[model samples]
Target: MQQPASTLATLWQIILRLIEKQGLDAEQFSRELGISAEVLRDPTARLPSRLTDRAFAKAEAVLADPAFALRAAECWHPSNLGIIGFAWLSSRTLHTGLKRMERFSRILGSRFSYRCAMEDRGLRFVYNHGRGDWDVGHAMTDFSLSILVDMCRTNIGHRLEPLEVTLRRPEPADTSPWRDYFGCKVRFGADEDSFLLDGETANAPLPTVNVPLANTFDAILTEQLATVFNDDIVSRCKAFLLRELTSGEPSAAALALALCMSQRSLQRRLAALGLTFQGILDETRHELARRYLDDSSKSVTEITFLLGFSEQSAFTRAFRRWSGMSPTGYRGNSAFAH
Candidate 1:
């Protein structure tokens, strides 16, 4: 089963920056939204998608501007989007850059995706969510479209306007801002969210394109797709567990709370994926045991504590079952091999 949708924590940076620019309390606002300080500080972390939608809604409300999220997007940084940002920057053309986004859109959020195709007007880019809504109030839709145009400009080394843009957002009272922002035809109350790039603009070779770097990114991103965010809930669980194991005793309920799911819900999702809570716990402990045993300085008792085992005896039994050797024996063998 696919992991639940989450928003990239870095994507929230712009909204938080905009809030601070307005002289509001970013810390208080983040706390109110259930965003932890740790999540905000970690560039690679992710958060519940609703928290992102709520932050955007607050931005719109605070400024009395429905399109405030678009303004917030001006703060977007190349590094904010993570590795895909660099891959997009080094793309051979606007079209290839977009193709990279099309493939790794999940890095933005599990729900976010795009369709890149050719149409009569130009090469089309339509935004779609895994679920129906883009965000609670569709504020994220504007941010996404705004960032799309921004990305095109940065990649091509100019503010090249879209050939045309269509938004599902209802027409706001004023329209000029939309026009000024996109610098192209803007359609409101549209059937879907999309934009187009003319054939010439789409294929124009980019000066920033670096073939070697782009290929390297492609390989790394391919591995990420295979292992990281490709709907593998088990991997997510193990990552959280690895961080939490030595902090204190860990349990399925605690894991569920961290994952934003109920214990029953987590169990159901795991079962759907042909997994169980105990299976994941044991597997995580086994993997960590091997790593800890490889470190000669770490004693068997210390390893037991780190893996959350009740006692050295228990850890020894489990390690023997997993590796056919005691923790001490495994450590000796590893040290000798080195």
Candidate 2:
């Protein structure tokens, strides 16, 4: 399947960093991933998701680190953090930064969603991997949070450790390494995934120079961020698609009207982006179906109805096309397979 433009942009960034750090040329990494070096240079170039998986696998094989992907977080620079980091730096305090993170997190990435709340004596940053695949979602969240913590230290000129780091994966037998890295407590196999911050620590002051300069940086980063399409249109369409699909039926006409565009224009623009209305619908259905199947104990038939399929047969057919097997077969092959 075609990879999303955002995915490609991130892959480009990762490859660039790896090349810079390992003192290897792009040609070498491209040979490992079995792609041309030319293709990697273009930010807009498209590749299959499987290719990315293969590239990371090859990197792991060479690096001899199962956690190579996670370790990639350390390479993230301040500029790569984009608008999120800029906003955090501009904020008056760490508390404000956390609030902005909770509010405008879509600017960070669409794959993961976050929830922040003040508990009895601490602040909990709960992150939900909204992506369908558990492993991918978990990896993204882990890397993102790790980088966020590192950035906090950089911005504040002090190490502000989390009270507890909760993970969805099982606890490894050797916990000492994690304890050393996070500089606090680590809990695994939690009911929900979150990073806990002490209330006092979260309210601490950051050592940012020139708040006005930080604001300027935020604006520049916002404008520089790469997107698959225009931000406003994409955000609106995605929101509408998600809402309509959750209902019994979703229609393109209704969506077009809601977006203040005729159905014909909508189709034309989406086509220009190499997508169709049906493609978006199917993508939404497939993503939601996978999430429900993995995260919930709902029956297949119920999930079909919940995803707005008129009949179980139609849902089953679509599932096969998306996953190369029946819904039951896919579920059986999944990590959360029941």
Candidate 3:
């Protein structure tokens, strides 16, 4: 696989803004992260992902702040994404804009892939990091999702509250910031990182749609995607699960069929990669369970049905196994804590 590089222009702007707000020396921090201060002047230049990651790590360490990502996101503008952002603004609907963004996400950051799938409840915008043992940075996740939400709000011309927000990182001690920013339930320690937009909100026509301009950008993004063909199986499975999850929990055989492969072949491929089909199913369920549980709009019984449990008792037992508490108890605890 080709190594990923981030365009320095956007990153440089983010760094300078953070420095200005926090009263830090831009040159000193650039040197600390092995980034050339002069590189910030080149609009078309790129920085390797390793160097970018180091800079983010140093920012968290020097500032002694866990919410550094959140702060960065608040400053993010659609124009920061360059052409992709322009495409989103020109899109005819929130759905179209999101689809465009998801399609060309690698152009923004090759380390992550974006996928959008429709479910009974709404649309899920998933962010999957590339295969690696590298430490995942919460700040990057926060910044990315926040920028998505901000873009959606701009298009819709109103505050956009997601149905649910999920993070791969464990729940922080204080989730008030995330809750405040998203204006909805936030879940952590999920199988993957994603957020859900209510079906109605997701399907709503955007105020800024420009059919001609959107078509122009679409053509450009399609060409970009063809040049960087990413045939990632894990991302494909997650996208499938996002669609079929509400309908029912898919068995390995069903999933294999959905992926257009024989069950044996699927199992063999997963084994080669040191993974199992059942493990993926379980992890997906665990992640969805957290999201469903956090939504006050859904009752435990409704959640059981949504999760594909045959009965509420069975779901409660599984919930206990996952969280060390009964379904009701877990819900109550979350409510009290928040």
TM values, all candidates: 0.66, 0.55, 0.63
RMSD of each: 14.2, 15.6, 13.3
- Superposition error at 136 for model 1 (Å): 4.0
**Model 3 ranges with Cα > 4 A deviation:** 1-9, 34-43, 131-136, 224-338
The sequence of per-residue lDDT tens digits that candidate 2 reaches over residues 63-107 is 533333444556776444455656676654566566656655655
lDDT minimum window of 10 residues, candidate 2: 220-229
Ranking, lDDT, top scorer first: 1, 3, 2
Give a tens-digit lDDT track for model 1, residues 1-338. Answer: 65777877887777777687767898899888888777666767888776666777676677766666676557788777878889898876788788779967877787778889988767899887544644444677777888888888887888888888888777878988878999998998887788899987887778887755775575566556545574667766776777677775589999889788899999999999889988888887875676565445668888899888778998999888987888888766622211
Alpha carbon deviation, residue 150, candidate 2 (Å):
0.4
- Per-residue alpha-carbon lDDT of candidate 3 for residues 138-159, written as tens digits (9 for 90 to 100): 7778767887888888888988
lDDT of prediction 1: 0.76
Per-candidate local distance difference test = 0.76, 0.63, 0.70
Better of 1 and 3 by TM-score: 1
Model 2 Cα shift for residue 313 (angstroms): 60
Best by TM-score: 1
